[model samples]
Target: MNRKSIAVDMDEVLADTFKKIVKTANDICNLSLSEVDVKGNRIWDFINKEQAKELRKAINTPGFFRDLEVIDSAVFAVKELSKHYDIYIATAAMEAPNSFHDKYEWLMEHFPFLDPRYFIFCGNKKVVHADYLIDDTVSQLDAFTGEGILFKANHNENTVTNHIQVDSWNEVLTLFSSLRVV
Candidate 1:
């Protein structure tokens, strides 16, 4: 099989970013929010603009990135995919400049095996080129010409149209294998 380039979104797909954000928000605001409640909802859904700003501030607290965790099967999946494709981390994160940098730093600290060149920070991923784009956003899926595999999670149910949806990283590996032959 020829080597193909794959682009992957960072936050939800690769790292448990949303989870940490919610936990930070709840801790800061003294609010009780379950993971189920935050799933499938946009950032604005649970918190207002002001609250969102506060959440971003909370993330800046020392050791936040050090404590961050990877999603289930993410490390193994990336390790396996690296053998066949040049994996790039493409993320849309300009909304909060500081947080974006923090997230990037966090990613680099955790996944040092990934080449720094492959880590791209963009406001719009639609302009990036790759044989495959693995993302959780439905709107982002529409922007790429290559096969867009929607990484299934809560709050992203609107992505059911015109895209391949995989509930697990193992399934993602299978999808790529199938695509390689086609």
Candidate 2:
């Protein structure tokens, strides 16, 4: 069977960006916010506009993307998905200049199972060719040519898009494992 190409996003889908942002907010700006409080694509939506500014600035910091806790079940689920698919880490790191190297290194450290050759760092998701694209950003999903899997993220709770929504890695595993496509 020809393997399907699966393009996965890096930030929220795999990197647990919300947790990092919250930590940064609390650590640097002394702002307390929880996962449920992050309700939109913009940082200001969930935080004090001033503190959100700080969080935004923190993201652009060179090493900010390097260390973050891995989301639950993502590593195992992707490992399993890679077995029957050509999995690629398609991250839109260009928008975040400082994140380029940090994101790459982070992936290298956390998801050592994925071959480095499959890592795609770009400004646009539409340029990527894949059978599926799993991302938290709705705009990326809108641009993808193939099926989009909207990975659940606190920032995107109210996002309404024409994509299949998977709340957890278990759902992804079930969806792919039960596939009969050849």
Candidate 3:
């Protein structure tokens, strides 16, 4: 029997990019902006234009993606999911061309169990052909042809959508377990 494929996102889904951004902003601007402050809205909208610009600059800088913490239980969940599905780490790397090397190394370090061949770094996530796509971006989910599972993030806290949503990796594993039975 052929296994169904799952395309998992990198930034907010598997990696704690939002937390890193919050820390970066706090360090650069001496502001005490927490994840709670950015909940239900984009980070760019929560801060001033100058602050946003500075945060954007930090994001664009190389080595920024190198030290991001992996989402809790993400590795174990993905490894468990991989036993039944084809797991692909599909990330929109083109948005930050400077992040490619760091992101690649980060994944290799945290997800050594995953085959490098299954990694996909591209401009458009629509290029990913899989049975399911788990991402934090609503726009990417909207454009996806397969079932889109919204992995909850601070920025997307207030997003109301038709797609299935998972707040944690444990929830993800639970949802996929049911899907796998179908």
Candidate 4:
């Protein structure tokens, strides 16, 4: 059997993007929004369109994605999964000009085991070719050609009804490690 390539998302799947963004919003905008306050996958659900604009602008400021914390066990889990499957980090780098390099550096710092060659920086996730695509954004997963693993996030927890959901990195390890790609 051929080695199945797994396309993993960088934001909520591996990095704690939502928490950081929420924290930033709270700190800079003086808005008190909890994880439970998030109503959808995008930021607009938590704040007004005008405030969301400010948040969107804030994403590119500096050290936004770069300083984001890693999801619990994400590094170890991906490293372990790499032994079983070909892992490719498929992140949408269109969010900001700095996101590409920031995310790249972040990956290098956190997942040193993963080769830079496996990193795919792109816009549309639908174009990504893989056997499995694990992401927090349901729209991206919905557009992907592969089997979508919905990594749960603060914004996406109450959402996502189509794909198989994995709440944590351990869950990801368990599912991927136990299953055989056919």
Taking the candidates one at a time, how many backbone clashes does each contain?
Answer: 2, 0, 0, 0
The regions of model 1 sitting more than 4 angstroms off are: 59-66, 157-159
Model 4 over residues 31-99: C-alpha lDDT tens digits? 887766765655566577777778888887767888888889998899888998899999998877678
Report every candidate's CA lDDT: 0.78, 0.85, 0.91, 0.86
Q: Which 10 successive residues of model 3 have the least lDDT summed?
A: 38-47
Query: TM-score for each prediction?
Result: 0.85, 0.90, 0.95, 0.91
Summarize candidate 1's per-residue lDDT along 1-182 as a digit string, tens digits.
66889999987798777777777888877779987877667655877778877877766555565556787898888888898889999887665445555667877876778897888878778887998899988888888878888998766855457788898889988887876644
Mark the 10 consecutive residues where model 2 has the least summed lDDT. 37-46
Look at candidate 1 and tell me the lDDT of residue 163: 87
Better structure of 1 and 4 per lDDT: 4
TM for candidate 4 is 0.91
Error of 2 at 89 (Å): 0.3
The better candidate by TM-score, 1 or 2, is 2
Ranking by lDDT: 3, 4, 2, 1
Worst 10 residues of 4 by lDDT: 37-46
RMSD (Å) per prediction: 2.5, 2.0, 1.3, 1.9
Stretches of model 3 off by over 4 angstroms after superposition: none
